[model samples]
Target: MKKALTFLGTMVLTLAIGVTIGQVSQADTPSAPGSADDPIVTKSYVDQKLAGVGSGGNTGGAPTGGSTTDASFKVVTLNPGQTLKGGEGAEFILRGGTATAIASTNGGVSDVTGADDLAQGANVELNHLLLTPRNDGRGLKVGSSTAYVLVRGSYTVQ
Candidate 1:
């Protein structure tokens, strides 16, 4: 009878110790950064980072009213004869008006949406996502009217 009681007490003690260890390990485990349990930064910090983007030059276009989670596209208006030069990896989508591709000696703009390459003087397709492969003056030249374009990444108007 004594051995049975001792065995029961040992089992209870082991169970209690196992539970305590489990709880301790869970408490010590840190939540992943940028997760729901632990955010990487505050809302203000994210806002400040967003504000710094597209600060220089003519940022006259508003964000496209779409279901995008972030403001990645900047709408830009270009006058006739003006060129929208893109830096490396710059993305462009001609929203309105007419424009032509301005290719450098290296190559031309990549029309990802159309799955084609636009050489210099090629007409830019409206609503197509164009990507500049290099920073060597590859972009779009506005036609004889005001052109509206959605630009993402580094670019300049000249």
Candidate 2:
């Protein structure tokens, strides 16, 4: 009985070691570098400088432009071939010059294939509940233009 127990213990240890090695090897494999064909990498800006908004701070240590509101503007723009996700608890407005947005949630109202095309001067606001999943919003892709502008809405991080 003791010898049988010893064999079982050894077997378990061997199996564990094998799995660890397999996982290590799998993780060590290098993925190809990101490219145009890969997923889009969107960038975020804290101010609306791209849209020609004046810098809102004092340059020479004196407050400028009277009393300014305490509103913070966050903008996220997608590159030509990239995609962006409005995180689970994020709210943002989608403004596009010429692009397509795909909404897929609640069993696919509009999947990626069913794109919501947008013309110049078009915008869509997406408001998500805090309890909702991050994938509830749409995936945006700029058709022929450079990128799509996203005006972030106010959201408190829980």
Model 1 gets an lDDT of: 0.90
Look at candidate 1 and give me any clashing residue pairs.
none
- Residue ranges of candidate 1 with Cα displaced over 4 Å: 1-71
Please provide TM-scores, in order, for all candidate models, with all chains considered together: 0.56, 0.31
Q: Candidate 2 lDDT (Cα, whole model)?
A: 0.46
Q: Residue-wise lDDT of candidate 2 within 28-64, one digit each (tens)? A: 8765556543323423342344444445554444447
The residue-by-residue lDDT of candidate 1 on 1-158, one tens digit each, is: 99999999999999999999999999999999999778988888889878877785436454455432223889999999999999878899999999999999999899999899999999998999999988999999999989999998889999
